[model samples]
Target: MMGLILLPQHVLHSVVHAAMGVLVFWCCTVLGRSQYQGLAIPCSPEPSPGATIPAMCVNERYLFLLLTGGFMGYTYSLRYFLHNMNCLSFPSVQQFKYLQFRQTVPKLLKLSCVQSLYLTRNFAAVYFFLGYIPRKWIQSVLNLQMDQHLPPLDTVRGLLDLSLFYQIWLSGVFLLTTWYIVWLLFQIYTTEVSRMDVMDGIRWCSYRGLLWTDLM
Candidate 1:
């Protein structure tokens, strides 16, 4: 599918997935060491006497969970794209029509469920990773310079600009691919219901949220 091979999109996805994988691997290794011998590997500087290295190690486990969840999400998203394209690429119209009547509905529903689960897991991972990691650790890890006051408006503007750039790149690919997938779903739904009007309903509901977001 043209949606599947969107140049550097796949490459960026691969890099993020690979980085997550490596982070998970390292966390697992650290966790193994910590579990077997009660060894506490120091991460950054000790924040306090009671706040031991083991705590940091545990936090690393949470980070690993986040990364693992992200990796799973990205992996499943790729699989969903592949499956959708495969269905679309079927040579025989008869086979495609038959699938629309029967197989496509169930398959798409299952994929939708899996995608939702993966997305939820990934979000959960990010929540815990961001919430639990110590601020000092984050600063050191990111090599970020701290400001005494809140960052200036210009700094905020710059951050927003960068975020928008990334969002446009990622979301553009996702939306295009998802639109085709949704189109296929509509075809299957219409076939089952014997109602072409359902497509308008589906499209309206799907784009409604996007419309609101764009307006905001």
Candidate 2:
């Protein structure tokens, strides 16, 4: 019999991760538009307050939301994957059950608690590493004041300041985003392969078990 009744794992992961990539792209595109980021704002010495760009774009909050929500789903998919993978790695009868990730890492799938922790961690990372430290380094090296408060995006200087902050933020978050996509791909690849295998196994077992016994 076929090892699994499924599509190619590579193709599956590509599609799944691509879907995630597209979503991130959409969010970024929306936030980075010329109107929003002050890209096309009329040249002025003063900061223009035409449309307030959400501070989340320039900090770790959005990153927090993006990763926490996305990873939660990724991990949940893993739960499903393991359930299927177990059937083949260690076959079991219908009456048997297996313990999962929770035993090793309690509340791993609890969304509320996990999200709260993620938010706190993201804030700390931004304050110490991703956002604050890098900006400070750049300001000290370039002799620029990165502490400008909500500079109007309509002016050249204001736009540059916002751009600088966001660039640093993006540079940091990009690494995590890349890894998250990779993680998604692996989960999809293994889970899908195991999905079909488990199904075929169940079908074969059912031949002489549930349906067979019932029909007989």
Candidate 3:
């Protein structure tokens, strides 16, 4: 039985990893595009009453909304891979019960929360570490004027700088984190092979315990 299931499991494992890689690449593209245009705008000083807003600053919320959507897409794809593994690892009748157990358990609950938190944290952490902290320290040391009335693009430029360096750095971090997650999931996939053996042991223990109770 293990031999029969092995081939399909390998195929599924490959497919899941491939899909995750594609999603990661897609996410990087979307996020890069969104930030590139906005971050390119230079910090413009106070403008006249009729001055036009920079193109990058306009419709800003829409870009972030798109970025959030792309992030969610990748996250859902990851969840699907986990669910697929559960299905492959158990019989149809037992699968539902196991899934419920996994979902409701505190450890799994913490895992889900951590995964979701990491998704949001990556962007914020990159900005804080590479953009915000360095920029603020430099400005303070140089005694540069902090313009309060600056545009959105200008503010982001001040925070993240107009250089492509931060963008590249952030993208590298994001991609590396994604690759780590894919590798971790693959480890889980391999362990699932022995899941049935553990289940059998559990069943035998329960049966023997019940028999002893009946004999007494």
Measured by TM-score, the strongest candidate is: 3
| lDDT per residue (tens digit) for residues 59-114 in model 2 | 22233234333443443334334446323342242211223222322333243344
Residue-wise C-alpha lDDT for candidate 3, range 36-130, written one tens digit per residue? 44312333454556868632223222223233334534554445554553343434343443454454355544554455456544644444444
Candidate 3 at 184: error in angstroms?
19
lDDT values of the candidates? 0.45, 0.40, 0.45
TM-score of each: 0.27, 0.27, 0.29
Worst 10 residues of 1 by lDDT: 150-159
lDDT of 1 at 95: 44
- The TM-score of candidate 3 is 0.29
Among all candidates shown, the one with the greatest lDDT: 3
Stretches off by above 4 angstroms in model 3 are: 1-62, 75-87, 91-108, 125-216
RMSD of 3: 13.3
Q: Cα-based RMSD of the predictions, in order?
A: 19.1, 13.6, 13.3
lDDT of 1 by residue, 1-216 (tens): 655656587656656654654344344445545321222233444457775432232232233333443455366446545665434332233345555546565665565555544554454445444533443465467554333232221232322433333322232234333534666765555545342333467789878978999999
Between candidates 2 and 3, the lDDT winner: 3
